[model samples]
Target: MPVITLSSDIGLNDYLVGAIKGQLLTAMPDCAIADISHQLTAFDYQQAAYICGNAFGYFPGDTFHIIIVNFFDQHPKRMLLAEYNSQYIICPDNGILTMITQSKPVDIKAIPIPATAKSLLDATKLIADCIKQMITGKKPDTTEVKDIEEKYPMRSAVGTDWIDSQIIFIDNFENVVLNVTKSEFEEIRAGRSFRIVLMRNSEFITRISDNYAAVQPGENLAFFNAGGYLEIAINKGNVAGLFGLQRYANASNMQNRLLYQTVRILFES
Candidate 1:
């Protein structure tokens, strides 16, 4: 039995997740079902894309990943059956699938799920049926499948300000993580003087310490996170709640929090 993993913005509060799993089991008895993550920040494609990209690699080969986020939201798109890195992903063609596999080569196919299957419940049933057919050694008919644009429109991984870094996602702990990697930041800060500034009250945090301990307790500091992305955090405070930094919700505020614009690094010789 092949492993089928499900991910989406659908919270656990409702029966949506259970309903999808029940449908999968009904179609393919004894099949393995796994939950990659159901709390995907509801309809935030980038968060879903990042979670799927980072977490799916840990699963075994032949895992069928089903992403059901933003299924009925604005901007209608097609279902996709893409094969990459020995795993198969079933998701919408709204570029989330493309972003996940941007660094690698993939075999893309547009799946034509019945339009009448408008609701998430109906779509899940149809998609599950299609996967069951594949597991039963039957190749699905793709004659009517609509092919997406040859290339996906994922924005370049590089930040809009190559010279400066962009604030991407902050964690529950209020750690400010930047889209720019440490290496890139180092290259940009070569011999140039800069400083990390907080946009909340225009407070200037000048010290770039090696770790949290490098700064006094309750002070703010910036360092490379485990993922190699530059991160900012208060020595012992919640940066987000304290600074009021919310992502995706407040678009204009995000631009104001840019490390270079809102926060800057001074590289002094």
Candidate 2:
């Protein structure tokens, strides 16, 4: 049986999720459906990319991942179907796919829709049809598959003594995940001592904890999470809430404001 995983901003509070699942099952009753998440922040592609990128690789090859966040960006008349690393991803062409994979897909196609078919329900039906066709080994017309426009993830700002990173994700446990990866941190440190300073509170962490419990309860610590990204958390408390840290998209500002909290790591010379 085929495996279908869903990640979306469509929360469970409404019937949309159930309705979509029903449509999928009705078309392919034997296929297994899995929920990656349904509570993604609306139109937040970075958050969706981080969550999906970390989780998708663990699933069995050939799994179909349906990402439905920011589906209506600019009222798109087409959706993208991409195959990467033996897995399939279906989502809007609003750059989320490129953000998730951090590269262009091996195979990509644009599924067109009639201008009259503009509702979310219509879009869901179209997605279901695409899923069915792909599973049956029927290749979509070559003309349908087109070059996908790409979008890049935010890069950390690096200096001789400092690496300025942004909080890319905040998990349910309220742990703050930064864009700085373990390898990047180690490469820059080169065995020198460093200080991780939080721009929000002016507080700093000097040690990298092996686990959350490495520190006494209620104390703050930093560690590279399972995804290998640096994370800040309290042993038994909410780091984001306590530190007043949140995730926001990079955007223009009239005053050139910083949208999210920044974590700066300064390596000792």
Task: Name the top lDDT candidate.
Answer: 2
lDDT of 2 by residue, 1-269 (tens): 88999999989999999999998998789999999999888766778888999999899999999989877767877888888888998888888989999988767888786698868879878888778887898875323565666787887899988998888899889999999899989998999998887544467889999998799998889999888999999899898887677775656552433434676789996
After superposition on all C-alphas, the RMSD of every candidate to the true structure, in Å, is 4.3, 2.0
lDDT tens readout by residue for model 1, 1-269: 87999998888999999999999999998889989888876545555665677678888999999987766655444578888889998887665676667643446666665657667777677788788888888887443444453333223133323333445566778677655566777666664555665663476565556889888878878888665667788888877667665443324454544433233444445
Q: Using TM-score, give the best candidate's number.
A: 2
lDDT of each: 0.68, 0.84
Candidates' TM-scores? 0.76, 0.93
State model 2's lDDT.
Answer: 0.84
RMSD of 2: 2.0
On a 0 to 100 scale, what is the lDDT of residue 245 in model 2? 79
Clashing pairs in 2: none
